[model samples]
Target: MLAYFGPRGTFTEQAARGFATPQQELVPFDTVPAALTATRRGETEAACVPVENSVEGAVPATMDALTEGEPLVAVAEAVLPVRFSVLRRPGGGPVRTVASHPHALAQVRHWLAEHLPDAEVVATTSTSAAARAVLNGDFDAAVSAPVAVRHYPLEVMATDVADVRDAKTRFLLFRRPGPLPEPTGHDRTSVVCTAADRVGALADLLAELALRGINLTRIESRPTKDRLGEYRFYIDLDGHAAEPRVGDALAGLHRHCQHIRFLGSYPKAEPGGVPAGNDAFVSAAGWVADIREGRGA
Candidate 1:
């Protein structure tokens, strides 16, 4: 079974369904952490949760859970093109109040401003929850995923209401940590780096990756929570950790940072892309393996 953040009609559920086989069951939890916790406790085979969005960046709650808890490994990822609909009850007088998950609201900020400038906006736990709120008469309308209309007694006043047409959210499939995935040539590795509070600390961390030609795909900072002014970086890089150059860059980063958490290395989202590292990286990896095995230097 796959556990997903949901009330049944959430984007997280959509992503989870894409990966599930016909016979596999999908269980919905109210929150992202709850779904992931199920995976950690072996209640589910995997958890599907949103990690980042193109417009909103990283999802803080998801990031915090991955950084703190009993170490879950991301096995795969799904990028979903998001399109939200403005939903209201049939014959609803007007949109006096708008409700939605904060991320969903943000994505349609401009649309809401231009269409219902004076409408009071409220946040909900999930987009589906927002629809439920509207159904319960807590609000007149909701900004929700297209699927939400089916689950709730809501009408689509407008479709594709996002300010940006190309907005996308990335969802990750997480499982218990195990052997690192084999290199796919086109892969991404995520890690968390906690650097000491000092001058050039952040720079030194980047320099280590730069020197080894590891291309960082994404980087975001989060509070370490131990104290104020102490932060850790969540970084995503182009190559798999199994690659020699990528492994070397991680080693260098480990020396410069206080703590390093290897999230996982998974296949990149793009299709038909060239594998990272090429022949040069492969040769170097082979040489290092040979030396470690005492076969040759």
Candidate 2:
């Protein structure tokens, strides 16, 4: 079974639907931590949660939650288009008050301002929750996924509501540590680590990967929260961890960093690129092994 951060009709639900096979039963949790915690507790096989947004960068709640508590590893991921619609009761009055999650509200800020300048914006826990508010007559309209209309007795009043034309969000399905997925050649390996405090610490940390020809896809740092200057970095690299180049790069990182946590290696949502130097790395390692066995000059 699969669990998702939702009350249903969330973008997470949409992403989970796509990530799960037809046989996987999808369940919903109230919060990101709750969904992930379920996976940690073995209440469910896996949980789906949003990790990043094109318009919003990293989702702090997800980044921090993944790094904290019992360890969970992302097994698969999906990227969904950031599309929203304004929904209201079929014969409802003008949209005097609009409700949605803060992230959803931010995406349609300009659109709402242009179309309903007088409408008051209210924050809800989830977009589906916003639809429930409209159903309860607490708000006149809700900014929600297009799918919300199917779940609630609401009709779309405004369609394709977005300030940015083509925004997207990335979601990951996670489960407790176990055997990792095999390398698909085109895959992603993610980790969170803290640099050893020194001159050019971050630079040196990145160089560990670069020297091994591992392509860094994304990198972001969050405060350790334990101290003022301490930070933990969240990184995504091209290629699966099982790949020789990636494995070696991580070994180099292990020796170079203050701390590290493996967040699993999984297939990319839109796979294509393979890291450079895998063949060279494998060959070089073979040569070194040969020398150690006294088979080389």
Candidate 3:
């Protein structure tokens, strides 16, 4: 079974469905951390949670949650196009109040201001939760996933509502540390690291990747909360840890950073990129091993 951050009719659920095998059952949690905790506790095989959104940046709760408590590793990822639909109960009426998740509302802020300027907006825990609130007569309308209208008996007031036409959200499936997935040529490795509080520290970290020829796909820093200026960086690189280059880069990171955590290396959702390679590192290791042995260098 798999656990997902959901109340049903959420994009997380949609992404989770894509990850679930035919034999897998999905259990929904009220929050991302709860779902991950379920996996950590062995209640479920894994948990699905949103990690990043093209429009709003990384999900702080998820980024912070992964670094706290027992470590969890993301084994898979899915990206879903973000398009919202505003739903309300039957019978067209003036929308006096609108509700949805903060992220969802932010995506449609401009549209709401133009179409429903007089409508007061409220925030809910999830888009589906907002639809439920509207069903329960708590709000006049809800900005929700298109699937939410089917789950709840609501009509869409507006469709294809978004401030950005191509916004997307990336979700990840996490499980307790164990054997990692095999390298898929086109894969991503993620890690969190704390650099020394000094000049050139961050640049030094990037320099390791640059020297290794490892592509740095994405990087985000979150406050460490232990100190005023200390922060933990969440980095995504285009390669699997099993690859020679990525392994060398990770080794360099360990030597340079005060602390580092390997999240996991997983296949890309949509694979299409240069394959990661490091034949030089492998040959060099073989050469050093030969010399260390009774054999000649």
Candidate 4:
């Protein structure tokens, strides 16, 4: 079974349906943590959830789950273009409140600011549940996917509700303790580490990878729990650990850094068929290339 973030009308559900094998059973959950926990508990062979968006930064809950001592491993990835619209009941009665999953609501806040200016933003457990709320007539409208509108038979009050066109979000496919199938060439390794608080400590660790000709892709600093001024840096690199340069860098990094965790090395997103004019896609590819080859001037 494959677990996904869903109640069916979510973008994650669409991602799982698009990338998964037809025979794979897609289990839906209210949160990425729940889906990831299900994978860790052996309830599902793999779990799919969004990690970041082109427009937004990282999904903190998803990152925490991956980094927080769980055996769940990121095994593959896919990107979906996010198109949001406002769904309402027929006859267009005045909307009282707007409902959606927190992330979905965040993604469309600018639209809400402009169009549904006075509508209250209330949190729902999932995007599909928001659609369900609107369907049940409690909410005047909801901000959700086109899939949700079709699934719940809601009317579209406005199309293209997100501020940016061709927005995209990244999804991770995870499983554990098995031989990963050979990649389709594009690949990435995600990791977490901490450096000594000394001034050059972070630079020294990064410099080692730079000298080894290994790319350092995405790096974000998340505060270490209960430790003031201490952080864990999450990094993504282009090549697999089997490569000499990458392996060497990890060895050197391990020596220089106080904490190092190799989350997983997995296949990267396949290039073709992704939507055009997406800033996030461009940003992700640049980061990937940097990690793969250290592409910096």
Candidate 5:
């Protein structure tokens, strides 16, 4: 199995390490779109990308990639806990600027308010890049994951520094056009559908799900990139499409919705397994082997 992620030390990469088999081949990209492109072009078999964060809410880029990419089915889901660590110069002083990826900066807004209230926030493209900037002494501090401090050779002044407790980010593994392995008792189904710009079209879609007693775990709306009033709905709900109620709701949704896309119905995170924030890095030896050999399942 080939896997793709944001960068070497971002939370997305950290999450991918945990889900991949020892033989999985991992690839890195600066943007989620680039990663999706790599997978779509058959340069890689599967791509891993972040979907949402507990603190920062939805990741718009991931949503956009899913909506635009060709028929990539989600195979597995994982939630990695986000813990921002404060990285500073060797000799700490009155730090004036805080740097981080825009999304990570949003996740730690409360912490920034409480700690560096006067610091200017600069948006970097990725957390790993922010940590590198701080390491080069270009920024006073960086808000990034603990893994970044080690990757970029930076010092951590604060651990779990994010303002919120128990913040988690969900990641999805995407693969194209294949019969996925059978369900393993724990899974989720994700779908994207465009509701009529008209009022009540969205309500009618939800009512269909409600009528079937299907519980929604997440619901998010994205601009359809059309006129200002048009929108698309992305949904994550309990159960798999192979199940009856879920399959029925999707069928009903397709009849009424303008556009319908089923991203995937795949296994969820392993219960009582490794918690999201504390993933250990083994050599990529096994992971690299798995992706190249086609044992991704």
Candidate 6:
């Protein structure tokens, strides 16, 4: 079974369904952490949760769950285009209040301000939850996915309400740690590194990858929660750990970092889709390996 942050009509459920075969079951949990925790406890085979959105950046709950407690390895990822609608009851009165997940509210902030400047906005656990609130007569309108309108007795007062038309969210499928996926050339490795409380420590950590010609795709620092000033870095880099140079960079980081957690390496989502292999990166990897083994100058 696959567990997702849902009540059946969430974008998370939509992402999870993409990976489910007819034989598999999809379960819904109230929160992102709840879904992931179900995977960690073996209640489900995998967890599908949103990790990042192009507009809102990182999802803190998902990040914290991955960074803390027993580790879960990311096995795959899905990118979904986000488009929200302003939904209301069929005969509802003027929208005095608007409700939605905080991220959803933020995505449509400009639209909301222009259309309903005085409407009081409230937060919910998920967009589907916001739809449920509208059903319960708690709010006159909700900013949610179009799917919510079909699921609940709500009408689309307005459609395509996101601040940006091309906004997208990246969701991850996580499972218990096992053999890492074989290198795909266009793969990404994620790790969490805790730096020592000293100057240049972050720069030094980054230099390990930079010196090896390994490219970092993304990096963000989250509070360690153990202390006020202490922080842990979440980094996404361009190559798989199995690659010689990438492996070398990670090993070098281990020596300087207080703790290093390998999240996983998986095929990166690309425009034309993940290629079987990149001839250029493959040849460069071979040259690097040869130099390391004293076979090249």
Candidate 1 at residue 17, lDDT? 82
Q: How high is the lDDT of residue 114 in model 2? A: 92
Q: What is the lDDT of residue 292 in candidate 3?
A: 93
Per-residue lDDT of 2 in model 4: 89
Q: What lDDT tens digits, residue by residue, belong to model 4 across residues 7-57?
A: 787777777877688898888887778988898899888888888762222
lDDT to native, each model: 0.83, 0.86, 0.87, 0.75, 0.77, 0.82
In model 4, what lDDT does residue 185 have? Answer: 44
Ranked by TM-score, the better of candidates 2 and 3 is 2
Best by lDDT: 3
Best by TM-score: 2
**What is the overall TM-score of model 4 with all chains considered together?**
0.76
- Candidate 5 or 1, higher TM-score: 1
- The TM-score of predicted model 6 comes to 0.79
lDDT by residue (tens digit), candidate 6, 1-297: 999877776777778888677899999887778988999999999998888872223378888888888999887778888888789988988999999889899889999999999999999877888889998999989888766765798888998778888888888889999998887677888898988667898999999988877788889987788766566998988888887677878999999888888888887865433333335557887898999999996
Predict model 3's lDDT versus the native: 0.87
In candidate 4, where is summed lDDT lowest over 10 consecutive residues? 272-281
lDDT ranking from best candidate downward: 3, 2, 1, 6, 5, 4
For model 6, where is the 10-residue window of minimal lDDT? Answer: 271-280
Estimate, for each residue in 75-193, the C-alpha lDDT of model 5 and write its tens digit: 88888777888888777678899998887888789889988899999988777788888878789898887767657766677888765677788888888868864665566788999
lDDT of 1 by residue, 112-168 (tens): 999999999999877888888998999999888777776787888998787889878
Candidate 6 Cα misplacement greater than 4 A, ranges: 53-58, 90-97, 113-125, 227-230, 272-297
How accurate locally is residue 262 in candidate 2, as Cα lDDT from 0 to 100?
93
TM-score of 1: 0.80
Candidate 1 lowest-lDDT run of ten: 270-279
lDDT of 5 at 68: 83
Off by over 4 Å in 1: 54-58, 89-98, 109-123, 135-140, 153-155, 227-230, 270-275, 285-297
